[model samples]
Target: MQYKPLIMGILNVTPDSFSDGGQYCVQAEALAHAQRMVLEGADIIDIGGESTRPGSDPVSEGEQLARVIPVIQALRCHLPSNLLLSIDTTRSAVAEAAIVAGANVVNDVSAGTDDPRMFSVAARAGVPLVLMHMQGRPKNMQDNPGYRDVVEEVLTFLVERAEAAKDSGIRPENIIIDPGIGFGKRKEDNLRLIADLRRFVATGYKVLLGASRKKFMGAICGETRPVELMGATIATTVLGVSAGVSMFRVHDVKPNRQAADVTAAVLRT
Candidate 1:
């Protein structure tokens, strides 16, 4: 499962995802979309039950499991076996159930700090874990968020998290780090992240860049529509790719995949 600069497609199963709310909440539609992404060149399917966007409400454990389990099971049954599955949630219970249902990875936005058991879960399941850096809770992450030095702060947070995960039995190669562009950032901070992405990668973990229709993209393009953020998102992807990002968690699977192909052919040489 060595993903060297792979594209991890975003599949939000929640009813209110900012990117595509309720688009694939239904079991059949979710399966169809998952298959579509796979066909479009998604190396990994990252299924998320809870929306971690700014001002988002929390989904209960039962709702989270209900939203994610069926989709994971259906995809595992219908999609190719080699197609990787990454569950996005902070609850240990949900991660456990998703792994049992067929998730090969755990993508915790809280970076294993929220659920203490996530480290053990990844260890037991023997799967990769994505650690994302978020300053505060999702509800108020976008409100007056400030950092003395965004890059250094995020880098320190990720370093501490990686040490903790290693202490909890998660292997070094099995760990991935995400800068969390929109989770709690202003325009300048997000831009700084895009520019300093290589600094984070120098920390020695696979970097996963998740800039799919984020708020900063909207601010940059002067567009409120999430879909319109695609072009700016591509620009950031190009920058991140040049900075040596290991994987991408994105919504536009086809374009990102195509862009990644070009990037791999041209830049990563």
Candidate 2:
């Protein structure tokens, strides 16, 4: 019942991120936010340049590269050298650039299905990578998606994809799996996956649950705005801790870290 939570702080450098959008798009603000989150208990900071919100269009690879590199450079130069830096992208070129700029983790929300080169990038980088499970492309994921059994299908996909990544030369220890709570799932599917997350951990790989501030939280909280779903986010973090989740991707770092600490304390008792 012990919790070893790997809190990956969200650093979305986009104009349309659900929260903290445009707020951190400026170089100075972004640097300050990264520093604060690391001080607030973020083991890692996930730097993403593109917005993958519902109905959002994809950014050009060149543009995406431009957005994240400078921020990563600042982080590498100013933040603690041991601070874990993650590039939240599926582009191999971006991955390579981020690594060369000193990022250590590659968090591909596409699960490497979008770009065939993703797995190979992780392999060559020799760093830990997170494979997030999403049903389809971000732009169309919420367009009336249907899955006969989301939990089963998602688990299968994670297993297959993890194996594929391993075969592509990524070691098992260098991999983490995320359920991708809102990408293509309804509220029910997300809940069931959280309830049954131990099955994923049983695979001997770490499971990182990223259900923070998602649309489902708004639906659960009956709020229209992303900021209003924070209480629900805390609840999900507690539930995730109860299920032995290894990491959490969140916008609210201090609250999530505190929730995790309390949950871990109770479970230990």
The clash count for each model shown is 0, 0
Give a tens-digit lDDT track for model 2, residues 148-247: 9888999999999999999999999999999899988888989889889988988888889898888887876788888777788889889888888889
Give the range of the ten consecutive residues with the poorest summed lDDT in model 1.
1-10
Off by over 4 Å in 1: 1-4
lDDT of each: 0.89, 0.89
Q: Candidate 1, clashing residue pairs?
A: none
Candidate 1 lDDT over residue span 1-269, tens digit each: 42246889889988888879889999999999888999999999999999887899888999998889999999999999999999999999999999999999899999988889989999888899999999898999888899999999999999999999999888999999999988888889988998999898899899999988888778767899998887777777777778889888888888888787787678545
lDDT of 1 at 71: 91
